[model samples]
Target: MADIIIIGGGIIGLSSAYYLSKQGHQITVIDKGDLTDNCSFGNAGMIVPSHFVPLAAPGMIRQGIRWMFDSKSPFYVKPSLGGGLPAWGLTFLKKSTQRHVEESALPLRDLSLLSKQLFQDLAKEPDFDFELRNNGILAFYKTEKAAEEEAHLAKRAIELGLDMAVLSKAECEALQPKLKLDVLGAVHYRCDAHLYPVKLMQALIKYLEQKGVKIVRNQEVTRMTTNGSQISSVFTGTKEWKADQYILATGSWSPAVAKLLGLNISLMPGKGYSFMEDEPQQRMSIPALLCEARVAITPMNGQIRYGGTMEIAKINSQVNMNRVEGIVASVPKYFPDLTPAVPALKDIWYGFRPSSPDGLPYIGRSPKLNNLVVATGHGMMGLSLGPATGLLVSQLVSGQRPEIDIQAFLPQR
Candidate 1:
């Protein structure tokens, strides 16, 4: 059995550990933080197979340019003096083409579908319970123009074999009678599932511990010692742990770790904010996305969670109130009857999603080093794609054929 060490204890790292341990590999996971709060815990808890379109799609450049100056815009890229930033931005613009979108749709859809199945199987595990709900997701649009755009996308999704239904305003209201929405129409994707992220993380950690996986929390991997092409040991302050293999699953901070090995990976931190209300009046039976606002609302374990905003800033954990207020403003727009009390500044939680230039994550082995696999760059889909990625990582490590074609996710291709 190979002694493997995984860096980063986020959902991706922990999930990889879970799968690798099950395959009889001795595993140790290290993280800088306590692993209690991060992107995996603060995400919009969506198992979305319908989100096949990558972020760097056609027409996004114009939209991003229009929203560039707006502080509370759904997507904002903070202009900076960094050298790599311009190169990444240019590459992102170049990939924002119809051909690229068409090319990416199939791989993203396949991975998401595989991930959905894995999540369903995980729900059936004896001691695993994280509020898995298959009530589906509704993407609501307020204007006729927005509805038309969504309808076009829905048709493409349907062509890709997704269970999608376009609903009129009245039909959408019938599904959720409480939400008096002011929307022209809605697109319902029945193939989606929702969960409570915090609950899921806690349950998975507990399950892994019970199964005898060594979880080393609060330990940061400072450096890596390599002998020729193989990594010899991982250094964490005073401790040196030797491993036969290493998996890099660090989220937004992955680039820094990759730099230690002289690997050039273009990953930016897209920060997002979210908050939970103690007693929210707007109780949703199904999760919904405010299409224009780009906000996601999930009914999780008796409380409502409002999550949105994509600020393309550097990896700083500062909570911008203006951005948080944007998410709060969107709540009443969708659920008019619900008036959420303004949360205190301290109550709002923010986490960085590791975004790639072309919206596709880097998931395969690094060509520079043998026995070192990279699994970061899931961006906003980290929670949605965690289990499937873990399974794929295990397959690669064990010298078995992967379930999906990993050419798109290759570290160097």
Candidate 2:
């Protein structure tokens, strides 16, 4: 069995450990913080095969620039003259083309569908049960402008062989007769699914432990000691850990870790926030995206979670109350029956999504190192893409071909 050390204990790291351990590899996971809190918690727990388009597609530059001024807008970018963001900006602009989006769609669709199936299989395992639902996701739009855009995207999705339906206002109301929606129309992706993220994380971690994977929390990798073509060992916060193969699954901090080994990856942290209501005044039967506001609403574990706002900024958790309020403000406009009470800054949960310049994940072995693999930069789709990434890492380690073509997700690209 190979000795593998996985850096970062987020969903990607833990999932990698699970798959590797299952294949009889002696696994060790190192994390910078205690495993109690992580990027996996408090996220909109949806498995979306419907999201085939990359975030850096055409017209995003205009929208991101437009939203740059509006604090309440769904997307924003904090200007930074340093930290290689300018270079990333240029690359992002170049990748925001029809060619990029078309090239990205099929691979992304394959990955999400595979991960969704893996999640289903994971649910059937003993003690791994959580709130797994096939209730699907509704992308509801209130504005005619947004509705037209969604309709175009839905047409593209249908052409791409995705299972979806374009529902009029009355059809939408028919599906959700309980709650009143203030939307012109909705695009229903029937292949999507949702689950309780916290439960999934807990179950996966527990299963890994039971299967002899060593998980060491609060141990951060500070540096790497490498040979000519392979990483010999990694220096962490308290000690140096060596392994035959290493997987760098650190979420938002992937680029920083890659730089330690002289690897170039264009990654930025996109901060997002969410507030949970103990008992939703208006509980949604299915998860829905307020398309105009980019706010995500999910019914999970006796509570409803409203999450939105992609703030591309530096690495910190200083809560922007305006952004949180913006999410709360958009809810009532979309779902009239649900007037949510805003929570204090302390009560809200926020985390950084590892965003790539082209909105595609980095998943493969580092070109410079023989035994190092990079499995990060998933952005908003990290939760949806975790298991497939793990399975791919395991396949790479075992010298077996991956099920999906991974050329699009090569770390160097």
lDDT top scorer: 2
TM-score of 2: 0.98
lDDT of 2 by residue, 82-113 (tens): 77689888889999999999999999999999
**Backbone clash pairs in model 2 (N, Cα, C under 3 Å; residues 3+ apart or in different chains), count:** 0
The estimated TM-scores of all candidates read 0.98, 0.98
Question: Which tens-of-lDDT digit does each residue in 1-413 have in candidate 1?
Answer: 89999999999998898889899998888899888997999889999998888899988889998988777888999888682678779889989888988999999999999999999999999877899999999999988888898999899999999999999989999998877887788999888989999988998899888877888988888888888898888888989999899999999999888888878888888998888875455457889899999999888868887889998878775777877778788778877875566579888888999998999988998897898999999989999999989999999999989999989989784
Report lDDT (Cα) of residue 35, candidate 2.
79
lDDT of residue 348 for candidate 2: 94
Candidate 2 clashing pairs? none
Where is model 1 poorest over a 10-residue stretch in terms of lDDT?
275-284
